[model samples]
Target: MGKNIDDYIDKGLKGTPETKPSERREYLSQLRERIILALTNGQVIQQKPYKPISDLMKRYPSSKLYLDGDLDYMHLSKYIRIANENNIPFTIVDDKASSTNIGLVLANPTAIDKDDIFVSREEFQRHL
Candidate 1:
């Protein structure tokens, strides 16, 4: 037989390439792993999606999360309490209430202050 069981044993072997190929898959996998690690360590601060109420339970792992919108009694009254209990900072701004009219901006806090939840025309515009 030209081929035998031994020939098929190295099934995991990939074809040898003639030229240098892009490491796209490897790069993407590394990036994904880093993201998951960041999230796991709380190094990756999170935010709700642009529209529709974003699910906080899955990411935050606690009630500490903010709901965007002043107009929605749902956001202000209910979610704020959850954030309070969860130790998550919450803010209400122009963006939360009127998403298309204004967008939201996320920030990390530095010296002299806790992380800020900034929402304003100037801040949102500057982010753009």
Candidate 2:
């Protein structure tokens, strides 16, 4: 009972414990298993938007788009347009403390447990 009280107090003081906080920070507040697609900061700034992202957005209307606020809005604007066009909700994760290269993540509220969540530029070109 004493331990339980201490734990409750700790929770109240520090907020609730999160699972895999580093991974969450890297993946823009979403778990790896829940991400349907992830793009690096460079990838998100490419001359053209990746087609697979639009396709995935169309396929997963229930999914949400997470954009890194660390990047310039110009880099994220294209995706924001895609999300709006798809009618999917989006959030900009602007954590200055987060040191991740990932710039965009499309995740379902529930875990989908996908093994391949990243699309490389080579893969995108081959598919194009």
Candidate 3:
């Protein structure tokens, strides 16, 4: 894998795919789009070149989802499904409360709640 974006940007991460701020946002935006489209279509959304986020969501219930740190869809989907499976609960703060600070939060991974499965990032990013 390429170096994480943060690593190259400022020695903050430890992975490949070093991405510029705008690049990461744009890439994440694209992913968020794919996920929402898949969910609406009731089809499986594949995170091409990476893990599939939809696959994991399909396995969970709807709770136990939380958006805190930056997370890719592939990983968030798993976290959501697991929460649903375990009946755990979480929530996604408003985009205003997001750490991305881009006026747009792409969920890298989003938060989930018992009654509300945060469709914010995917849902919101969809139209963007």
Q: Model 3: runs farther than 4 Å from truth? A: 1-65, 97-128
Best by lDDT: 2
Assess candidate 3 and give its lDDT: 0.35
Give the winner by TM-score.
2
Tens digit of per-residue lDDT, candidate 2, span 25-83: 99999999899999898888886788778889888889999999999999899889989
Instruction: List model 1 lDDT by residue over 1-128, tens digit each.
Output: 54665455544365433232222122111122122111110111123222211333334332223233424453245435544544556555433222321112121221123233233334433432
Q: What TM-score would you give candidate 2 relative to the actual structure? A: 0.93
Error of 3 at 77 (Å): 0.8
The CA lDDT at 48 in model 1 is: 27
Provide the overall lDDT of each model, using Cα atoms, as 2-decimal numbers.
0.30, 0.90, 0.35
Please rank every candidate by lDDT, starting with the best.
Answer: 2, 3, 1
TM-score of each: 0.26, 0.93, 0.23
**Residue 62 lDDT (model 1):** 28
